[model samples]
Target: MTDLIAELDPTQWYRDGRGPRYKQLHRHIRGLVSSGDLAAEDQLPSEREIADRAQISRVTVRKAIAELVADGLIEQRHGAGSFVRASSNRFEQSLSSLVSFTENLQARGITSASRVLLKGLFRPTPTEAMVLGLSPHHQVARINRLRSGDGVPMALEYSSLPEDVLPRPDKIDLSLYELLRARGTAPTRAIQRVIAVNATAPVADLLDLAEGAAVLQIERTAYLASGRPIEFTSGIYRSDIYDFVSELRLD
Candidate 1:
């Protein structure tokens, strides 16, 4: 704490013409975390200690700490002071490609795994039936999974496939696309809609995030080469760790 206090001297961090004082403090502390000067899980000095060393008011210090917490750079524990959070791995997924979550992680050299929360053949819901072009009387294979990369929970996925496309839900262990391809039912294209949403209680629990955390909701309907809709899937992903990118081109 002493070393940290000395390093945060006002002369070095607090400066004129650098926007707000609180923001300056916030950037300095963020730099420390990024540079590994303040490693993950390292305890931060008390607000009073930092304020005293930086020659700033406690209010200023508190505001800076609040910004850090909101940025996911630090976390405050009740009665335990602030701590640098462990850096999370950020993954960029290309919107131009049609790929599975498992494939995306594997391409990045991350070990992908899933915890199957639910899987069975069931009557298709209205949305599922409409999206997959299934009749109300037809059944669908529903698979729900908590997806992880290198053991970090990253997404909660729910997928419904026409029974003809996925006859055996129990046979699915890893990639659903792999099974579909083996059965000659792989989707050649998809229409996806992405939206920002706050995590609900169940989604937060599955993704190991606090309730109301920002998340990306993706709803997709995938089609076979013959233009038949085969899969309808919805997923909630951690916004802090995922970036969806697209390359735009002019005609």
Candidate 2:
């Protein structure tokens, strides 16, 4: 494994001025995978070795490895270290690109259904005010739902929107994107922040998990084509059942 990794070009990261050193390192690893040099199920060089070889800090190596893991390109074992993961997970992502949840799931051949927990008007809290970019005392449409696929709970979606621009709660269906489209407020783009978290009581109950089970907490803000804020959502997803993936094109 070390010998295979040693063949990689060290100048790849410097040539690619896309982001920080960590992202560039990630792109370099991705390039190795694509070039057929890093075979399937191959174990990657240890962080210490990679750090020495790349002349970067071990912390940088760890950060690069984490991004690859998040993108589902690698998996770490207890005592064995990180290795290439199955390719199934890489194709399972539609993190952005403005597609409906139902559509994305159906395209992946997964069963997706929604249970509406709440759909009504509410005043935004300070946190929500910051997320939704709302006034201190502005009304917003609050939609809380449990999104499941293949009969397994995936996430608890907590969303908010400016009430003046949204329709009444009774008109909402399972697909919020569809409803948004019908109301002429479809989301054209979105920004997402994903983080690992431990489930609290309410989140555990919603996902049918034992307390403190790991979860992915994703915070998102969707926007319209005109750059108008459409919705702000905070989602807690079951880590065992869901993954977020994306391809970072490497030079």
Candidate 3:
């Protein structure tokens, strides 16, 4: 802890243009945690120690530490000062790419697996028929899966495809895109909408999150090269561990 205090050089705590003193300190500590300079479970110096080392008011130190705790980057224990929070398996996915969950995880060297919850060929529901351009008599192949990365439950997915596009739903043990590509019907593009939702009891159980925890609900329609819709998928993702990033540029 003494060494940790020494590393928080007082001179580095304030910058000419950086907003406030508290925010500056917050960013500094967050950087240290992100860079692994401060490992999980490592104790942070007491507020007085930090104040003395940085030559700042204890109020400033307290405000900075409070913000860190709110960010889920640290925790305060009763009678035990504060500590860096244990790292969770957080993942960032790019919105610019059209990729399957399996492919996304594989690119990061994370093992991906899916547990099939439901799979069958059935008459299309009204919404499914409208979305897939299927007639009432047409059948849709449906698959529901619990997707995991390195054995940690990540997302719950339910996908509906034209029956002809996915005749053997049982054959999909991993990447749906891989199977579609092999059949020469892989989606070339997609329209996706993401929204925040509270976890239901069933969703909470599957993702191992508390009931009412915030999660991301994604609805996607994937199209083949010829502009035909091939798949309609709805997924529930644990927001605590998943981040979707999109780059913006001024035209």
Point out where model 1 deviates above 4 Å.
1-88
For model 1, how does the per-residue alpha-carbon lDDT over 1-251 read when each residue is reduced to its tens digit? 23687777987676576457887787667656654678889999999999989888999999999988976789899999999897745689987788899999888899999999999999999999778878889999999999998887889999999998898998999999988988989999998899999877677657755445578999989898889999899999887678999899998
Segments of candidate 2 deviating more than 4 angstroms: 1-91
Error of 3 at 230 (Å): 0.5
Error of 1 at 154 (Å): 0.1
The model with the greatest TM-score is: 1
TM-score of every candidate relative to the true structure = 0.69, 0.61, 0.68
- Ranking of candidates on lDDT, top first: 3, 1, 2
Ranking of all predicted structures according to TM-score, beginning with the best and ending with the worst? 1, 3, 2
**Model 2, 1-251: lDDT tens per residue?**
33545643466344443456776677557545544556669998788888888878999889989977875678999899998875724224557567766778888897889899998988889877876678977888888899987776678988888887674865777888888887788878899999988877577656755445577898889988888787898888766556678667789
Q: Residues 1-251, candidate 3: write the lDDT tens digits.
A: 22677667767545655457787787667656655678889999999989988888999999999978976789999999899999744789887788889999999998999999999999999999999999998999999999998887789999999999999998888999999999999999998899999877678667755445578999999999899999999999877678999889999
Each prediction's Cα lDDT score? 0.84, 0.75, 0.85
Clashes of 3: 0
lDDT of 1: 0.84
